[model samples]
Target chain A: MAALVETINLTRYFDIGRGQRVHAVDDVSLTIGEKEIVGLVGESGSGKSTFGKTVVGLHGKTSGSVKFRGETLPQSYRPADFQRLASKMQMIFQDPYSSLNPRMTVGEIIAEGLRLHSTLDSKQVQARVEEWLVRVGLQAGHMSRYSHEFSGGQRQRIGIARALILEPEFVVCDEPISALDVSVQAQVINLLGELKETLGLTLLFIAHDLSMVRYVSDRMAVMYLGSLVEIGKADAVYFDPKHPYTEVLVGSNPEPDPELERRRPSTAIVGEIPSPVNVPQGCRFANRCPKVLEQCRSVTPQLITLKDSERQVACHLYN
Target chain B: MTGVMTSPQTIPALLEVRDLAVEFATYGGTVQAVRGVSFSVEKGKTLAIVGESGCGKSVTVQSLMGLIPMPPGRITAGSARLNGVEVLGCNVINGKDIRGSQIGMIFQDPMTSLNPTMRIGDQIAEPLQEHRGYSHKRAFSEAINLLSLSKIPEAAKRARQYPFEFSGGMLQRAMIAMAIACKPSILIADEPTTALDVTIQAQILDLLQDLQTETGMAIVLITHDLGVVARVADEVAVMYAGKIVEQGSVDDIFYRSAHPYTLGLKLAMPTNDPDKQHKLNPIDGSPPDLFAPPPGCGYCPRCPFSMKICDSRPPENFEVAVQHFSRCWLHHPQARISPAAPSIPRELYVGERA
Candidate 1:
């Protein structure tokens, strides 16, 4: 099957000043198939959000090519090109509180996308806005209210309504449920999963929660310090993680059961994530990887396919 | 085994919070931040209060320490007894005298909680100087010792540095050091590990557990994360809106919970258990508004099993087992249809095991 979206050696760096740069995303090449949810998992400073933003044209790529439907996207997408892509690709921001404009009514916020992307009449736009409001679990009465009037979960639903109102085929959900309460998080996740099936939408689900990614995504990719460490089927990545980083990450998730939590063996990954500005030349996770080798000091391992399998890992131990 | 001493239950509670009710006089109206929240902490045991952002978990703990601001907020009801002495609204002894010296608190963010301009050593030593009447030199030396006890490497060197100079994990460790400097009988850690990464959070939890063991100090853990609560709490109180809908031991709350909301919250998290491949059963609606909270059960609006009477009549805590209790209409026995289970899928059945 032809990939819906593909990136070749994608890299993004921010100039933090004094001629030094922060490597936010580095040499990442990935493919997203049609109607598939690809979960991008990583911790803070892992650059998962930056990678998602770069792909969706929220940030300019420092290097590498991004192809959508086999058409190459510019390194820094032009406003016209980006505006054209806005109808097809959109983003659900992380912080629901700050993402929506407080001044605008919920109806206006959801309709803004429609007004920009389509030539719908004002009455038609109002109807579409109300329809989306109901679709995302909010009532028509909530349309005239301000963003601050609703709770975190309600605000997130508004965000989803705004993004999907344009009928974007591909949406980058950047930590959509992280800020929500546990109960509300499931509602949002289920909504996203249902919308994926109903709308045939493709998603790049970016999150630090490993277990949640396993549940929502068809395939999962693990990134560490601005580089891909592992990628494969969600079950394969979660259950049989090949990379040492992925291994600890999957194990570090605290089990909800009290008895199991007490009995589970320690899976502590020591050492804080290093500053992106001062990234090491070798493996970025080498400092914390339990199975570090002498060769890991100077040599960086590229993602390599395992024998007779689709799993890919970027650890020298596998070699 | 000291036959003179009985079981842990008989041991007088180190800190007892009875029917705490706090109201915030907001411009919109009166916001009932805490409504009849009652729990107790025994010596060396941890009682975790788990709830979402505005669920009164923080307010309950803050009220215990007399930390709630008085102008807009006031404790309208209840009493907190420390070793049988009344603490809440007690005029005999100032609450401030007992706050840091006896009932110490560790807030969520260590950076803002600790004075920014002051050095960390001084910040940790302030309570010591103020409460224990320790002089500058003695308090400074004691602060370094406390730092070392918290497992901060090169404690003496780190002590002289400001709060910003230390890393996040280090700052949390310093906060622990400050909270425990006096060896207070009760320690209230409100989301202490929420701000740290998983690895750092684990380390902080371990440090707190170790400190509890060494000092035999009761810990009042207020947090929203169920996993954290399960790992640390000896007893758990599940809060919603402004009330504890369920309260029991970790096992009772997790395996045999009676409240529908508790079950909903549990099924919502993405568990590591491989058998749970199906979609989570999310509670369909947002939490109740506290400004004009429903007169009945706070959770009646979102509860899947709510009965007709639940709309008008408030549910009280019904004892399910020896100590396990749930505040729900389903436990009323006669209305026994087991309030309709939330909209969980049939394939991903929720009550199969419970």
Candidate 2:
């Protein structure tokens, strides 16, 4: 498979007052193959969303490069640049309540991208909007309805239609189903999977749910404190996690089984995540790592591939 | 044993709610938030009310706590008794006095729930001062102890800091410390772990379990997460459109579910099994509008095995097994004689056992 989207040493930093910078994304290099779904899992404030946004040119990169189809994208996306690439790569936001514009109708919201990027007239744009709405499991008649009239699940479907109307090859889906109800979450996930099959779309699915991510993605990447700790085949990373953080994260996720959940020993990770502004000198996870080594406190571990397997891990134990 | 009390084997429940019905009179119409919800909480046991966002789980508990504002919100019909004393529809049980002393509560968002202006210790100590009549100095010291009990390291230092200084996990721990400060007999945690991360959520759940075992207090956990309910709850109640659609033991709900909504909820979750990542079977369509709630079953529109009777009238509770009740028309005896009745596939609901 050809590499459709590649980020080499991508870094994004947010500057606070008094010369302090929040290292939201730091030296993160990842690749998404053609028609592949790469799942990104991390705790809140771990910079998973920042990395996704930076990849799609939603945020200007502080350092490094993003390559789409072997063509290097600009460091900062201007209006013309965004207009040019709008048809190639798109993004789906996390919050359904605030993502869609309330003033605009669902039809106008979905058609905005098509109108901006293409030479479609009013009739053609309306027709395309209705088609995309129906494609996303919503009725064509729902195009004229306001966002407030729909449920959280319906609003999310509208968000998906708006992003996919342009027929982008690669999309950044940032926790698309997290805001949805438990019953409706599966509907969105299955819809995304089906769309991936029919449209051959590559995705960077970012979510906090490890189990859900493994079900949706071909490969899984674990991020911690603005760094990628592990990346491997989704099932391999979930079942046979190599990194200490991945192990704890996967273990902590409760299965929806009564007997199994009750019988499993409760081993919660100790200590809270350190502030990104003042990141510690050593490994980011050293403070709370159960299997911490002496050197782990002073030497930062780089992400490295294992000797016999395709799995990559960032831990002193692996070394 | 007192003459007025019942026999030892038939001891009254610690907190018993019978036919709990709550209504919110909105501008559009009267929203039947909770219609005839009934359950009991025993000593040292956990009963989880599982449902979607607008399924009336929150309203049921909120009405009991007097948290619901009047004029618009009213307990149309119901009785919640604590220790054989009527707690609902009475002027004696003011929210301030009985809420902290007898029944403590925690909310979903710990950040917003905590008092940001006051020190963490002061907020925790307020309940002790008001309920237990403790001095400021003594209550503050006890607050630190309570923090330590909730597994926060350097409890003394943490209590002195404001809410903004603590991490989300620590803030939740602080909230837990405050709720358990009075050592209430019944703890009503409304989605306590929803806002926290997975690791942090696990820690909170573990703390709740530990506190329950140590104190021997009953817990009424309200959440939409089935995994959390499976881990913590001994009994499970599935609510839908303001009704208790199903009530059963944890094993009964998971392994042998009778309600279609419960089964749909279980099936909708992404399976952990790698070999069977099959297409998930989602209960299509949103829930019914509560402004003019459906006259029939709330799940009638969404149920895969919907019958004519399900759309016309609600079904009575049928005892499927010992202590297991499902409110569905399919459970009716005459339904088997009806034409084209689809039997619930038992294999789908039978989860893998250890």
DockQ winner among the candidates?
Answer: 2
lDDT per residue for candidate 1 within A63-130, as digits (tens), equals 99899999898778788987899999999999999999999999999999889889999999999999
* Lowest lDDT 10-residue stretch of candidate 2 chain B: B1-10
Error of 2 at A190 (Å): 1.5
Count clashes in each candidate, considering only residues at least 3 apart in sequence or on different chains: 0, 0
Kindly give the stretch of ten consecutive residues in candidate 2 chain A with the minimal lDDT sum. Answer: A262-271
Per-residue lDDT tens digits for candidate 1, residues B1-354, read: 111111123356788777889999988999999988777788989998998889999988887787788869989998888999888875223445788888888989987888889999999889999999999899999999999999998999999999989878889899989988888999999999877767778778888988889889999998888888878889999999899888888888887776888887877877665685656878776778899888888888787777887879878677777677787777775775544544655334333445
Docking class of 1: medium
> Evaluated with lDDT, which candidate comes out highest?
2
Estimate the TM-score of every prediction. Answer: 0.94, 0.96
**What is the two-chain DockQ of model 2?**
0.81
The runs of at least 3 residues in candidate 2 whose Cα sits more than 4 Å from the true structure, single-residue gaps closed, are B1-11, B91-95, B337-345, B352-354
How close to the true structure is residue A2 of candidate 1, measured as C-alpha lDDT? Answer: 61
Candidate 2 docks at the CAPRI level of: high
